[model samples]
Target: MPFKTYLINKTNNRKFRLDGVLRSRRLPAKHKLCQKFRQHMVLRTDQLPPKVDLRPDMTPIEDQSQIGSCTANCLAGAYEYLTKKSNGMNMDVSRLFIYYNARIKGNY
Candidate 1:
């Protein structure tokens, strides 16, 4: 089946649409890295760099090609949240990165 992308910005409640198709099943099976990215991160949260808090600024992120790659956005947001938490400052994460990662995850 062909998949569509959709992105929603939590900060300003904006939405971004992208034109593309993702065949989750067709993703290269040999690229274990692709499948394991999230899992790997989950196991080593403490080791990973802390995320920044971006809520204070709450600047919305962009929707990447409308591909519904929210995971990347969430990751970016987390980074922003952590950053702010550590330094008492906020940051805007790149939504494009989130959208891209979501599509890579396929059905994530």
Candidate 2:
């Protein structure tokens, strides 16, 4: 078992105060967990294709150069890809529109 102590406060009048203690009991060793994680993340680089372009049709590489609206751009791109794939329709969704709507909804 491992334990950690957290200090709540150190007031000018009082010296110090203990806030809480966190105790953790290990079911498996650290090395074992690391080995398992490494095994899960192992990839065969040679088997992968040299070039993979998964972008959908009408999915433009947007230049959100001036605006800080990367989240909106990504959302619109995903929407275009999904809609095109599902319905075979090539509709260009406006990133600015999505950005404004998200800002109104307080999502950003």
Candidate 3:
């Protein structure tokens, strides 16, 4: 079944379509993150440093080339970043290897 949704503004009424919006299933309670792991910061602008940028320390962008392996690419980037920041090594991680093991670990 298809349904129509409308959005109205005080000044002008506009028609909008929301049928293509996607809804995801909520994660099970057991899978939810612990309260300690979740951070909810409340701070004024002056409380923090004026600027913090880490792009210069990141590895060069890796090309996925139309592969549906974003999970692998993301993990590889983070791993490379940690290695570079900690050991001062700019080694590149293999997305193919990560994707392969990720599929196995995830049972995909």
Q: lDDT for every model?
A: 0.66, 0.75, 0.83
Predictions ranked by TM-score, top down?
Answer: 3, 2, 1
Off by over 4 Å in 2: 1-53, 56-58
Candidates in order: C-alpha RMSD to true structure = 16.0, 10.9, 17.0
Quote each prediction's TM-score: 0.33, 0.46, 0.54
Ordering by lDDT: 3, 2, 1
Question: Model 2, 86: alpha-carbon shift in Å?
Answer: 1.2
Q: Where does model 3 exceed 4 Å of error? A: 1-47
> For model 1, how does the per-residue alpha-carbon lDDT over 1-108 read when each residue is reduced to its tens digit?
446676989999787877575545556757765664553335467776688654564535556566665667667877876777678776777778667556677774
lDDT digits (tens) for residues 1-108 of candidate 3:
446676667577666665755544565477545333436687798898998999977999989989888989999999999999988899988999999988899898
lDDT of 2 at 94: 94
Any runs in candidate 1 off by more than 4 Å, and if so which? 1-65, 101-108
The prediction achieving the highest lDDT against the true structure is: 3
Clash number for each model: 23, 0, 0
Query: 1-108, model 2: which lDDT tens digit per residue?
Result: 234444545554443434445544555556656443443455599977799777645576889898999999899988999898879898888999988998989965
Best by TM-score: 3
lDDT of 3 at 34: 30
